[model samples]
Target chain A: MKVTLIAGSNREQASSTQLTRYMARLLEEQGFEAEVFSLYEHQLPLYGPGEAYGHEEVLKLSQAVKSAQAVVLTTPEYHSSISGVLKNALDFLNSEYFEGKPVLSASSAGGTVGVSSLGTLQGIVRNLHGLNCPEWISIGSDQRKFTDEGEPADQATELRIRKAVDTFVHLIHRMYG
Target chain B: MKVTLIAGSNREQASSTQLTRYMARLLEEQGFEAEVFSLYEHQLPLYGPGEAYGHEEVLKLSQAVKSAQAVVLTTPEYHSSISGVLKNALDFLNSEYFEGKPVLSASSAGGTVGVSSLGTLQGIVRNLHGLNCPEWISIGSDQRKFTDEGEPADQATELRIRKAVDTFVHLIHRMYG
Candidate 1:
């Protein structure tokens, strides 16, 4: 299965990207192909109503999500909500791209747990007509805290993330198989 | 009294902008000095966490909101929520500008009334520590449909909008007077 991941932060080399990369590796281990779409790396202009299909970046992201068997979207919480960059990308497409796709949501937090952003994202997924997996990954501070060895400092967060991913993978497998 | 209005749409000459302009006029009539900050005219780059202070657009908007006695935010609903452009602009600043201010939110809908976006916006204002006025302005299609002479087709919407504006101004006067 092919999965598309969205790293929904505008910071350079953000923990949101790192987290998505980690998610991709785990999906790969489970016999899935994955690609990370970094908002920081591919900056789309502010969304324009009735004009997204003409934009290059929107076309690319839309194509990736449309063809994928499942999607994983990761965001850094901003002011108790999903980052505007992520929401902006999502605003460009609608049910056409997301319909019936199993989407797993995760958040790259800023010190605290990203609970509110996850709630808002779930609502958004419902609006997009996507099948939102109930298991959420709110990257608490420990999940992104890196040690001097350049690895996440805590393994407990990893286990939590794995469980969510495994559940999402199981959900996708049930749909396609 | 100063009231800062945000026209939260990226479209050129959007109805969202027009709605804010109308609100500004109403506030001006109520003896409140009003300024409509057009997000469409002043395009902000996607927000970078902890880096907004350096950006010119952010500084301008933050200064405006900080100095204003009250605020009126208008948006176009997208995906059953506030437009990403509006939320993106908001993600740049926090309670430093909005603290203790009375914020009245309005939305210029695509076709239906933007009730969900208004609810979401109220939650965001609360997160920013602003006092959210309970009365909301959910601009229905009648509010934006223009006549041959460029006036709104339905005067009923104007009356509703005026009521909302009156309620907001009353709340502000209670605070400042």
Candidate 2:
């Protein structure tokens, strides 16, 4: 019923966020309640002795994560992996937040190899005891932008993104129902 | 003959720094030139279209990375992976910087599971084409600190740190030689 979306990019308004927002909108159109949590806004201290266990930010983040029915995480590939900001947030709530949640991962990259970041994240998530959607929503930079009229100027990419969103929505519905 | 150690933790001074500083000290004692760079202070911007290809900070960071004959990267584990700050910095540099250089990775975590960050980092460095030493250094939190004055508060941890340092230094010498 309630789905939480995490925008994993550190940039104020990244393509990953825009794409995820678009997907969230589609999910809403299909009758699911959704909320977006921008990871960049969470000011988490570096995990350490005094900070790792009971840091205020950690506790607050964990509480938010505990209440979610399903989570959608969006990230941009950095050095062939997920951003530290996202990983740090996930690290804080490990077995507690991720135990039985169905997580859908989506990624945006600058090249045809947008899937690299997705693959790396999948590997990391699999090892963390997460149940991930078998098909990930991956967008490369070939046709990264849209016009002011909200139309994708590049037809090929428009089709790809449409398919990605449809598949993701299907996966979420299957997982939740 | 100059080696630059990148301390990846966000803390002003961290165990990774302590361990990296120890390596620098050992290298200096053995008569090799070295310097340590605290990556947290670099404040690198997240990679974007214009930012990733070339930026002032990216140029400066890459220059530092390129100038070094060998590099020692130290990080704290977060979500079974390396920190984004360090990965961001590495992503700024092209593969030429790491093509044939020797790299040593060390990590300090709060528990036995700290090995995740180390393993993740090793995978990244290898993917970047850095010649990594097979033996990596991993220190759990229970063994890294002391009460007040310099003392071996935990003999077992002291021994592990010493062994880790020794292996790290030996590999550096071999790589540099």
- What lDDT score belongs to each candidate, Candidate 1 first? 0.80, 0.69
TM-score for candidate 1: 0.50
Best by lDDT: 1
Judged by DockQ cut-offs, is candidate 1 incorrect, acceptable, medium or high? incorrect
C-alpha lDDT (0 to 100) for residue A1 of candidate 1? 82
Model 2, position A44, has a per-residue lDDT of: 76
The residue-level lDDT of candidate 1 at A163 comes to 86
**Once model 1 is optimally superposed onto the true structure by TM-score, how far is the C-alpha of residue A76 displaced, in angstroms?**
0.4
Candidate 1 lDDT, B18-83, residue by residue in tens = 778888888888888998899988788888767666788888888888889899999998888999
Please estimate how well model 2 matches the true structure, expressed as its whole-model Cα lDDT. Answer: 0.69
Clashing pairs in 1: none
DockQ of 1: 0.02
Whose TM-score is greatest here?
Answer: 1
- Docking quality (DockQ) for each candidate: 0.02, 0.02
